[model samples]
Target: MPFSFPTGAARFVAATACALALTSLVGCSNGEGGGGDSTTESATSPSKSGGTQVTINDFKFQPASLTVSPGAKVTVVNNDTTTHTLTASKGGSFDTGDIDPGKSATFTAPSKPGDFPYTCTIHPLMKGTLTVE
Candidate 1:
């Protein structure tokens, strides 16, 4: 015979424990555990309409490095609690103005193909790289 909980409360507790264990396992497999590479890369492929997107969450870019076609539209999503801006660190190649919290902004990739480093204008410490191919 299989083991079983005697009461409804006990069953609920058992189910919750199982759910928590599964959640941990899922988080571990994905990069959500913060144990693997700290950066993400979307190289040269983006949806036709949505385009390439860099998610800003927890004060960092989800995909720290991205590669897109020249003049392609790059969307900057601000999922963080505070506002942020994806601005080019060096030359004024690309800037997404200011993206409020829960908001998003878009910028056009430079025509010239090369590596373009960027950072959050409000939070300079947050940095990322954009490659135009």
Candidate 2:
């Protein structure tokens, strides 16, 4: 005898598999889908003299890495559903305290040129790097 599922079990399994495959495809499509890329940024323009914007979504910084002019103002926007912080790692420089959902904060870049690491104090796993030049 052959093994078989209940009346609707086979259909359900098929539908589930299809859904999972589609979800996987979407997640791998672009930087907007899933949180895979470690150095992704959503900034469409360069870090000008005014400021650069970084978006936080999906519990991760949209642009995980950025390069800006020295003393430039970096704006961090939290688009996620939870609060997050853009705190400098190892007490390097600036920290944006408790950025609520849909809110934003600004921090001035270091006057020197170097790589500065930052993370979310609330979610330590969320990390980012800022390069001042």
Candidate 3:
């Protein structure tokens, strides 16, 4: 028996197939509401925009959490290709409805001091926390 290497076209086909298979395996999903699969970004982490903004990208919250003073004007920027929202999960305290791709929305942080968890109404699995100080 003899062994031969794949030709250039054959190698290209194999590489492409592998690439596509990997892409599908890791494609982002607008997941259903569930336990957060994300980590809360510390209060000291760099802010997205002037310390009053959060970003939505790759089907996840950029910080996955935030801290701000009460009644702060927080901006939600949707950098993902799809629409998203940052909505309060508990008491409907805040919601940035249907932030389209490249669009932004602003909501006031609750006047009360506490931890307010939020999620994307469209993809609830994407969750975050907002701390009102």
Runs in model 2 lying further than 4 Å from the true structure: 1-49
Q: Write the per-residue lDDT of candidate 2 for residues 53-91, one digit (tens) a residue.
A: 778887677688888888988888898666889988976
Model 3 per-residue lDDT tens digits across residues 1-133: 8987678999899888887787457545534344667344655243465558888877878777788898888888899767888999998999998999999999888999999989898776787889888
lDDT by residue for model 1 over 43-115, one digit each (tens)?
Answer: 5445446698888877778688888888989888888666788999999999999899899888899999999
Q: TM-score of the candidate numbered 2?
A: 0.65
TM-score comparison, 1 vs 3, better candidate: 3
lDDT for residue 61 in candidate 2, whole number 0-100: 77
Candidates 1 and 2 compared: the better one by TM-score is: 1
Candidate 1 C-alpha error for residue 9, in Å: 30
Rank order (by lDDT, best first): 3, 1, 2
Q: Tell me which residue pairs clash in candidate 2.
A: 40-63, 41-63
After superposing candidate 1 on the true structure, give the runs of residues whose Cα lies further than 4 Å from its correct spot: 1-48
> What total of clashing residue pairs does each candidate reach?
0, 2, 0
Model 3 gets an lDDT of: 0.80
Model 1 scores what on Cα lDDT?
Answer: 0.78
Give Cα-based local distance difference scores for all models: 0.78, 0.76, 0.80
